[model samples]
Structure formats: structure tokens, C-alpha cells
Target: MIADAATRAVAADLERQSAHWVAAATTFLDAEEFASEAAWRSVETFVGLPLRRHLKVIVEELIDIGRATIALTRAARRDALALPEAMAAVQKLRRRYTQVETTLDFFGDAVSSRTSPQLRAALQALDALAGASIAPVLTRAGLAPIPVLTYVDKGMGASILRADIRLWAPGSINPVAAIKIVRHNLYRPTSLFHEAGHQVAAVTGWVPSLQESLGRSLAGDAELRAMWLPWASEIAADVFAFAHTGYASVTALFDVVGDARTLLRWPIGDPHPVGWLRTLLGCAMCRAAFGAGPWDDLEAAVVTGFPLRRADPTVRALLERSRSRMPGIAVACLTAPVPGLGGSPIGAAVDPARVSPAALAELDRTAGAALWTSPHWRRTEGIRIVALAGLREAEQPDKASAWIARAREWMTATPLAA
Candidate 1:
């Protein structure tokens, strides 16, 4: 009789613990958390519906687990055999609670950052640009473009969390492709397309194919082939950005990765290419697509700034061999047919010629002042305007401030298509 009384007390405690967690989990995030209506509206305009639905489903699942756990505790009080099952259920509930907490915290931080109206509008513009960058390729590859949510954060370069991946919460896939655009580069965000390229490559299976093509291209040298294969994902993303934005992508890349100190320092197992070679590879893409232009000047500056003598001898040899094959590597990235693209080269989806230096200049000449002002033009040609802005920043450094302001104006003015 005493043992029976002890068992009941334990069961009651377990039920109370589960009930407490259930109450805590019920505090779901909503627009009420924001300070102003405008803040909530801006966040709602971009990521509200999908994120809310996703969170609701997660909370419901968590609540169901908690209730089931409470039932298990009640069963434990009746039969000793039920005690172990009840304990297991409580453990499972705890695991689930932790997972749900992590998932909610991640999204809560991302959504809350958009409370500022200006930051929200800039991110919205980036969302539109990301769509413009990846839609053609994804559509051509017969894959639907996922919802893209861009947020500004501190960093020198941007990063991405793809939509197709599984999330922290069990049985949940990430609902949106979240791209982090660095704080400083909002006005000249070619890196935005690079992050979007990661999403495109993931959905289309471009990186694996490009790696194979690159391996074949460098078949003559075993060391060189091994060295380049690991960097294929980053290279494919660079190719994607270059395909959509031309020399503008190259120039923007220079600004981010052009530090002379770590230019040739290849960290063990790092996926990114050495900074010097990466800049040159971007220039190589420009040369392959547009004959010769400002990229050559930029390339000359890189070579002069980071002389081969600065690199260790083995690294220098590898760099020399890689330099010779950059043109072929660039060509392989652009022209290699992939099954995801229905056997069409990635270049076919977004022609480099469309955003070539000459093409961007022609667009500027044709559209004249109206390109920056007209809603129709802003909506239709906003991507090109982005390319042109990067081009101006690269070629005409003196006018970068004006271009930055112009970019901000259009970006805030234009909203992503519903």
C-alpha cells in the first residue's frame, strides 16, 4: 500500500511537469510582439503567412506530444508496467520541447530583425533580386522556385540556409530559403545572387555535375584535379552569379575577397578557393563571355597586388597550373549540360551576353533617366539595374555614392511580385 502511494505521487509529479511545459509552449509568436503596426505589416508582407503556418503546425505537434505524455502519466498510476512507458514518453516530450524551442528561436530572431521599416524594405528588394536571379534556371530545370527570405546581418560575405533541408524540429522541412545579406553590402549586393545560386544549384543538381566536368578538364594533373574538386560548389555559385550579372559579379567579388594577406592561404578542407584565384576566376569568366574589358584591368591589379613569389612554392605551382586552366574551367561551368536542365547548359538559362558590359551600357543609354524612375521599368528591368549599379561601382568609383543612393531608391520603391 505504501509503494502504491509512492507510485501515485511520482505519476502526479510527471503529469505536472508535462502540463507546465505545455503551458510554456503555448506562448506562440505573433504580430502582437512588435512595437508598431507598420513593423508587423512589413514582416507579414514578406514571410508572415508561410512562417506562421509552419510555426502553428510545430506548436500543435508539441502540444499533442505533451497531452499524450500526460495520459501516459495517468496510466502509470494504475499499473506498475506503465511506469517505464510513462518515463519514456516524458523523455520524448523533453527532446521534442528542446527541438521546438531551437526552431522557434531561430525563426523568431530572423523575423524580429525586420521590425525596422527601412531594413524590411531593403530585405524585400533583396528578395526580389534573389527571385530574378534563380527563377529562370529553376524554371528551365522544371523545379519550382522556393520562397526566399533575405535578412540583413553583420558579415563581410553573405550565406544561405536552403529551403529543402530538414529543420531542427522533427518531421519538418525548412519552409523558406533564408539568405543572409551582409550589413554593409546592401547597396551593392552581388553576393545576394551568389547565395541564391546555392539554392538554384541545390535544386538543379548543378554542383555535382560541374565537379565532374571540372575533374575531367583537369585530368592531366592529379594534384590539380584533387585541389579543384572540393571548391566546385563555390565555383558553381560564382558561375551562376556571373551568368546572371556579368562583369558586375566579378567586380563585386573583388571587393569582398581581395585581401592581399590571405590571398593564397588555402586552409585544409576549406570549400572556397584561395582568394587570389577566386578573383581571377571571376575575371576569367568575364574574358570568356565578353572578349576583353575592365576585368582584365582588375585581373592585372590582382596579379600585381599578390605576386606569385608571396605564395609557398608548392602553392605557387598549383596556382600557376590552375591559372592556365581558368578559362576552360569557366567554360565548363557555363556550357556543361546537366540532366536537371534537360541537357541544356546553365548558360542557356541566363545568357551572360544579356548583362555584358556593353549590354549594361546599352541598357543605360536606351532607358536613359527613366530607368531609375519609372515603375514599369523598375519592375521589368530591376535586375539589369542591379548589374549596372555594380558595374558603375567598379568602373567609376567616384560615382559609387550616387549609384548607391539610386540603388536604395529603386530597391525601396520596388516590391517583390506576389
Candidate 2:
């Protein structure tokens, strides 16, 4: 009872803050009814739910899907949020998703595991609430939605960018909304805001230099894309997330993920930001945003846990001012083909096989029918189809040029499909 009470108490303020999200979403959607093609799709993505309705829907969907248990998901999310190794989280979530899928598949066959409708309903509602809380913030931040966002189905899940855009789209620049959904569902559905922030940053081009630089620096030094993008993106996301949505993101963090992973925090972990540091940044952002919560308890928790500090006001202002430039950057980046072999650090960090499939699905969904399909690159042996796209984008070549080389390499040296 006490635990439940404490949980609810903590959730109260977070809930209150998110209350208007749905209504705001509704207003935005209504206004977006006449949005341009890209805007229409953005609205369509937002069409699925307003802050309130979306939360309700997500809550219901999670229940229907039997992923209603928030305790562990939240714990895992919080724990992993701080863990900077994106691949570790991807690996961990894959294990969890697989375990859940298998267990649910079994339980699906056995009717005895069914819970009461009330419990199911409540679970769904909570999920919707969480989802509801994050989307609007992302939208307002100017992240547009791509119909089939950044999906790369490598089986473990889709390895993908923190969020990606539909360069092929007519004129939608910085589809932050599309990226947010991909981020939210692809990994953990709970920390929608944190992921959305990264999606927005990447989609918006807030830290393109950093992303590109990291990609270049790390590519030469590392074998995997997850080595740095996750950590760097996490910090960048934390900055923008706090800037756009305030401190509830931390609560969302706590509510979603829990304890850090052993492998994730290891200095050797690929996603650069160490787990402890990422979590600390998350908490620090929260501390700065709301000036500490009730009795300064939340503030104390963040300060004690993260031990991270906030960006100076001038820096904050610069980011805020620069927020509007994302769409332009995204448009420019996508229109001009990136170089092959090496390009953006952000692109360099993508490993579709290693990314969460849920994320890829979001990307797929965001891509909105114009799914970038490369036939020859289809999964064969260890070579992933989705990853080919990132490699293509990273290498900056015509689709054929990108895959032909990879295919040739595979056939000559490592061609085992099964």
C-alpha cells in the first residue's frame, strides 16, 4: 500500500503537468486538419491520439498486448536511461521483448492468465497517459513525423537512428513527431520524451556538428554505430527535452526505466555516454527545470543521483534560438546525399540489426508508404537489410552503389544467409 501510495504521489505532479497535453494535442490536430501534405501526415501521426485520448489508447493497447506491467518497464527504462550504451539497451530490450513475447505467446494459448478488465483498463490508461505526456512536447518542439520513420528490421529489432526523416517526403523538414514515436515505441514506450528529444534533435539538426563529428571520430575508432550516438544523443536529448517539456521527463524516466545494466555501464560499452552519467544528466535536467519537486525531494533525488549540472543560460538560449533551424538542416542533409563509407556521426551510429525493431516499425510507420526498399540488400547471412539504408546514408551513395559493394563483400568473404 505504501509503495503504491508513494508511486501515485510521485506520479501526481507528473500527471498534472501532462493533463493539458491531450487537450493541446486536440487543438493542434484540429488546426492541422488543413495542414500541407507533410503537415497532414504529421497530423495523421498525431491523429492517433490527443494527449488525453492517446494516453487512453496506448494504455488500452498495452493491456491488449499484455505489456501492462509498468513496474519493470519503468524500472528498466530509468536504469537504462542513465546507461549510455544504446546497443546495451537495445540488446537488453530485445531480451525483454523476446521474453515477453514468448511468455505472452504461451499465456496467449492459456486462458487462465487473463486479468480482470478493470486491471487491463487501468494499465492501458496509464500507458496512454505516459504516451500522451510525451508526443505534444515533441510536436511543439518542431519534430515532424515521417510516415515510415527510421525502421531497419535486423531481427533483434530494427537498428536505426535515434530518429530519422523521410527525405523523400514532399517538403516536411525536421519531422520530430515521426522521430518521437519511433523513439518512444522502438526502445521503451515509457520514456517517450527522452527519446523524442533525441529524435527531435537529430531530426531538427540541433547538434548536427556533434553528430557528424562523433560519427567521423568514432567510425575510425569503433566497429559499431551504437558506440557513441546513444550517449551523445542522450545528453543532447536531455537538453532539448528539458528545454521543451520541463522536469516531468525525469519522472517519466523514473517511471519507465530502472537499474542500470552491468554491460551497459562498462567503460567498453559502445554507446559512449556511460550509464551513470546519462542518468545523472537526466536527473540534472529535471532538477534545473522545475526547481525541485515537492519538499525538494525530487530535486534532491536528481542532484544526488545524477550529480550532473545544467548548461549555462547563454548556451541554453543558443539552443533555444537554434531550434527553428532543424527542419532546414534535415532538409539539406537528406536532399544532398551523404558520403558513403563515412558521413554523419549520427548516421555512422546506426546499426539496424542492433536497433530495437519497435523503433524500426515506427520508422516504417513514419515513412508513410514510401518505404525505402532496397531489394538486393534484403537480409542474407549477418548482413542486415535495414542497416544497409544507414550504411547507404552514411556512405552517401546511390542505393545500388551502397548495397552492391556490401553484397559483393559478403559474397566474396562472408555469405551465409542462415
Candidate 3:
């Protein structure tokens, strides 16, 4: 965690940038429909820009890492260095590399500041739109509004998202939904719509914020318990948006998340489901609701923008895998956790060095087994474990070596299939 003073400085800088971003995202917040659009405008502006910036920085870090690794390899190969000199250099690089990687990959970074207009708009839009969708539902359902903070997050367009939408819940109250929106020439609108889908889950209370889940998981949420609710929540919102608004939202999401705004890069391991998959679900929803004529246009709006790998097959499959109409995010909120976690802190802490290799192996095994029951949740759990390993190493250096050894053991003992 950052020091209070450091955090405060970061917050101040974010405050400076939020204004413009809020203006750009006004439509998404739709706060004019509620409070003065500008009332929370600062934070709205603050969030999206930083989220994008953080993502940009992360992608840059990844680029740096790959470059450094190549450089290291080349340098090592160029000269016959002594063992100690080579080892010292490797260790220094490893530490520096870890800092960059940790800063980039953690879910905490996805939790953008709220004081800035960009930050504020990002939060306000997420909360406002999610609130709009959710407030009505909760009022109808007779549940009081829970105190949940919203953050417009990165990773909504990550390669790790196996589905088109997903959520993370660190607890029963706080929730976050990640949406997949690839960017393009006309991405802002499409991205707005795509995130609207994610908000549906937040409003319904399907999952917690990226920060909340990451914070709690780091704080100690059980892994299995943490993953289930969010997965259901995200999927539910995705299906709902798809079924209700159709590909307009899908296209919106794809356009922005996919587009590279100069220094800002598209995110990796984002909370949202993959854009192509999201398009598939969107098509399914539209056709199911209004018979699908414009889906290709809507879907095409996003795919046309990105340099995607499986463009043809992926696009074809979205419509191909359509199944029974998905229930809403609100419905998902009512769902409970699937069994397991053995009552351990799978969500919060995964200190590999603290546990036996057997336990580490079991952790991977259980996560794999759970995926068979619910892959949506299971994949996140696996990622969470990976993230947790990173967290432990960063915070507790004394345990890092053991954790690394156990991690290796766990990797060797557990199969990626699980």
C-alpha cells in the first residue's frame, strides 16, 4: 500500500485532470438525469483518464520488461561474465522488473481516483449509470441502497477475460463490473454503452469494485467465495445489456477499450469479458429480443478497429454459442457462493511461501476443479491467486523466496487445464 502522503499527492494530481474527462463522459454518467451533472464531475473526469493512463503505463512497463529481458539476454551472451557479477545484475533487474510488473498488474491500479474530473466522471458514470439501473431495481425489490463505491476500471478488455462480462465481489456489499470495449475512431460512444452493461451488474449488486475485491482479497476474502458472486454478476449484466440494448452497447465498449489514445494502451487481464465474446453475447441478446439485423454493423464497429487475432472465428462464434436467454444482473446478486475454499482465505491472501507445497498444489487443484463447475469464477480465482502471489512478494520480502519456491512447486504440480 502507498503511504498516506504519497496517496494524497497522487489524489491531488488526479484532481487536476478529471475536469476534461468528465465533459467527454457526460453521456455515460447521465447525471443530468439525476444531480447536477457537474456536481460529481471532477471525479468522473478523474477516473477514466487515470484508468487509461495506468493501463498505458502498464503496457509500457510490459514493453519495457520485454525489452529489458531481451537486453539482459543479449548482454549476458555478449560477454563471459563472472558468476557473482552476472547473478548480481540478474537480481537487480529482477527487483526492478517486479516493481514495474506489480504496479502495472494489480487490481488496485484499476481503482482510479475520484477527485479529478476524469476520475470523477469515471466514478460518477459508473455509479450514476449503475445507480440508474440498480436504483430502480433495488427500489422495486425493496432493498436499501448499500454503500458501494464505483470505479471505471481497466481490464475490461483484457485477454484474460474468457467471457464478455464479469464482476468481482470482495464482499456482499461492494461490487465491480468489468466490460470489454475495444477502441476505434468512434469508440467513446460505444465504450459508454459497453460499460453500461457492466454497470447493470453493479447496480444489481452482483460484484464489488475492482479495488474492493482486490483490497478485500488482499485483506483476506476467501478465494472461492470471492469469485463466484462476481462471475455471476458480470455475466448477468452482460447478458442483460445484450438482451436489452443489443450491440450498440457492445460496439461502444469495443471502440474505446480497444483504441489506443496516444500514451494510453488497451489493458490486459481486464475484468470485462473479451470483446469478441461480448459481441457474441450482444448479438444473442439482440436477436433474442428484437431479431438480429443490425448486429453485424454493431459488432463490426468494434472488430474493425482492433488488430485482433481470431477476428473471423471469434466473431462467428459469438452468435454461434447463443444459448438460453441470460437472467439479469439483479438475479445474479441473489445467487449464493458455490461450495469450497474449505473456509480458507482464498480470496484475500495467497502467501505461497507460508503454505506447504502440498497446500499450494491443492490451491491450484481446487481452483481448477471449481472451474469445471464455474469456469467464469474459476479463472478469476486462478488469476487472483497469481495476483496474491505478487502481493505477498511485494509486501513481505522475507517470505518472498519461500513463496517463489512454493509457487514453482504449485506450478509444476498443478496443470494449466485446471
Candidate 4:
């Protein structure tokens, strides 16, 4: 039953590493500026707060590992099986430690990259988007301080990491969704609203409900139900964005999915629908949220620009079935009363007017300079309005960053209520 000296030495080394890791993680958490400063709320609210919570979990996990290894090593002195358990525990801990390292590395990069103006503006712009568009809906639904953050990825385009396993641990702190977008994309950043919609789905269970409701609705047709099953989450997200951001969300969808190449292809097995169908579903939801005028205009523009002659036959048929059922799906998602809204639709709860495309476009003319001058546009309206306008006015990337910075400055200048 006695183990080789080399194996004993390995077990002892693991125990030491576990203790060292706990110390290092705790020290990092204590020294990290993100944990203390309220001044960093606008920017740090997105990244720093979540990182702090995650690091605490790392520290706790390492401490547990340390104790377990110590016990196992002690037991291994007499029991032969204890060596294997200790070895397994050390191996498992190594993978867990790597996860911490990767996240720490990401946090470090996120912190260091703040020197870039576009990244700063992207952070602020996302904060504004949340404060304006999502916060009210969450507040109305009885969840406050959802704490959404956006990080710039020079390598990737606009996307959301919902319930990311790396960023969240069971029984840890609150869940925060991090939106990753290309640096300085102020004009068409309404994608953040779509991303937030995914986060909302996780927190509210609205998507699951919508999926269930949609499954029941389409149950009469097995083909449609099978197709709709995977797409339920995506549709829920699109509908959520439309309901909250109204015309702005649809316009942004068009911006991203408007091209000819994207419009014609069928995205089989993808969680997202084809680009053309996504634009149309968004329009259908917009019609439900803001009325027909916005939807009609968006639909007409897409049809005129990118006709769907190139689409596959089966895909076209699936889209046709989807379109017929979209209104029912939209109603199901938008009208379901959450905790705080008193049975009103989420759109009406966030912004009563549910801004129109024409109005958003008009506001974009001023590049959101009007937001500072006019008290008429509420903070929610101002966020989408300025983002659209800034993107429209900006001819280059740096200009877009400047526009976003200006918007952030105006937003942070005063405390605007929802």
C-alpha cells in the first residue's frame, strides 16, 4: 500500500499549489480597483463588478481544493486508494485553475485595453443602452440593477455571451451578461438591445414560456414545430428587443442582415433564423409593438433591396410558415405580464410612445446633440436615438467613437429617470 516517494512528492506539491492559489486569488481581489470605486460605476459596472464576484468564487474553490488535497495526502499515508483520489482531485483542480487563469487574463486585457477611446466609448455606449433601454424593463419587471456590461473584441463582431459558464459559478454572485461587439460600432449598435434580450430571457423565463407557448401553437403541424423549436430562443430575443427598443431594434437588425449574401442563404440548424426571415420576424414584432407603419416601411425596404429569388425552396416554405405564425408568437412574448408591469406589455412599460422609425431617423440627424438640449426625449429614447444618429453621422471609426463619447458624456452628466 505504500506509495513511491515521487508520488508522495506530487501530492504534496498539489497541496502547496492549492494554498498558493487561494492566497494569490484573494490578494488579486483585494488589490483590484474594480471592487472599491463608485466613480467607475458607468464603465466598471459592466466588467469590474462581475470580475470581482468571479474571483471570489475562484478563491473559495481553491480553498476547498487545498483542504481536500491535504486530507487526501494524509489519508494516502495509510490507504492505497487515497493516492488516486488525491491525484484525481489535483487533476480536476488544475482544470478549474485554468478557467480562473483565462478569466483573469480576459479581465486584464479588458482593463488594459481601456486606453483606447473607442473601447471606452463602447463601454459607455453599452452602459447607456442598458440604462436607457433595458434597465426600465428590468425595473418594471421588478429586477433592478441587472448590471449588463460590454467588452470590445478586436477579433469578433457584435455578440452576447448569455449564461457564460466561464463568467458564472453556481451559488456565486448575481448573473451579468457581457456583450462583445466590434470596437466603435456606435451607429448600428442596437445589437446590444438584441443581446440584452437574451439576458432578459435568462432572468425572466419569458423565453422558455414563449417557447412552450409557441410549441403548443405550432403543435398542429409537426414540421413547423420541429423547425420552430430551436428557433424559439432566437425569436424570443428578437421580439424582446423589438418590444423594448421599438423601431430602433428593427432598424439595427436590418443594418446587420440587409446584405444580399446574408438574405438568400438558409441558416439550417443555427439557433438564429435566416437573415431575411430574422429581419421579417423583427418587423412582425415591431408591428405588434409600435404599430404597422414602422413594420411596413422596414419590410418594403428589404423586399426592394434584396429580393429572395435565390433562397432555397424548403427554406422559403419554412419562412412562409414562420411568418404566418409570427404575430401569435409576438403577442405571446410581449403581452405576458412579468412581476412589476401590472399586465402591461414590456414595451409599454419601458416607453409609452414606443418610438417610431421616422422619429428615430429624425433624431439621428442631429447626432444626438439634441439630447443635451431637449428635455423631451426621455433617457430611454435618448439612448437609441443618439446611437442611431451617431452611427449615421460618423463617416469613420474614430468619429463614431467620438460620437459615442459625446453621448456617454451627456448621459452621465445628469441622472435621468426611466
Q: Indicate which candidate wins on lDDT.
A: 1
Per-residue lDDT over 1-418 for candidate 2, one digit per residue giving the tens place of the 0 to 100 score:
1235445444343333233332332332232222233322222233223322433332243333222232333343334332233223333433433433332222122111113333222222222322343344334444343322221111221122232333221221222232222223222222333444454455445454445544554343343224445455555554433333333333334433334332123354454354433444444433333334331454355446543224334333333222223233222322221222133322223221222233334544555334333222322111122222322332343564554444333322211211
Candidate 4 or 3, higher TM-score = 4
Tens-place lDDT digits, model 1, residues 1-418: 1228888888888888888888877765443432244544565344567866887899889998899999988888887678878888888888898898888777666655675667877777787778778888888877775778787788789999888798898998888888888877887788888888888888888888888888888888999988998998898889888887788888888788877778887887999999888999899888888998999999999898888899988799999888988898777777766668887878888888989989999999999999887877767777888899889878888988888888888777746453
- Evaluated against the true structure, the overall lDDT of model 3 is 0.36
lDDT of 4 by residue, 1-418 (tens): 7766776676677567656655655554552433223223435545456656666666677667656766776666555557788777766666665655565555555445445454455466565665456666677677766666566666323677654444533233434566776644443466666677777766666655666766776768888778776876777677666655566566666666666776757667788767777787767766765576646766887767766556677676776776778777566666655434554545565552434555566665654556564546645355655444433333244575665565656543443332
Minimal lDDT window, size 10, model 4? 31-40
Question: What's the residue-level lDDT of 190 in candidate 3?
Answer: 23
Model 2, global lDDT: 0.33
Model 3, which residues run further than 4 Å from truth?
1-126, 152-233, 243-245, 256-275, 298-418
TM-score for each predicted model, relative to the true structure = 0.93, 0.29, 0.31, 0.73
TM-score of candidate 4 on Cα atoms, chains taken together:
0.73
What is the per-residue lDDT of model 3 for residues 28-128, given as tens digits with 9 covering 90 to 100? 22323323434333333333344334334433543444444434333434333422343344444445445543433333433333334444433343333
TM-score of 3: 0.31
Give candidate 2 regions above 4 Å deviation: 1-190, 209-230, 255-257, 260-264, 294-418
Please report how far candidate 2 places residue 147 from its true position, in Å: 4.7
Per-prediction CA RMSD (Å):
2.2, 24.8, 24.6, 5.3
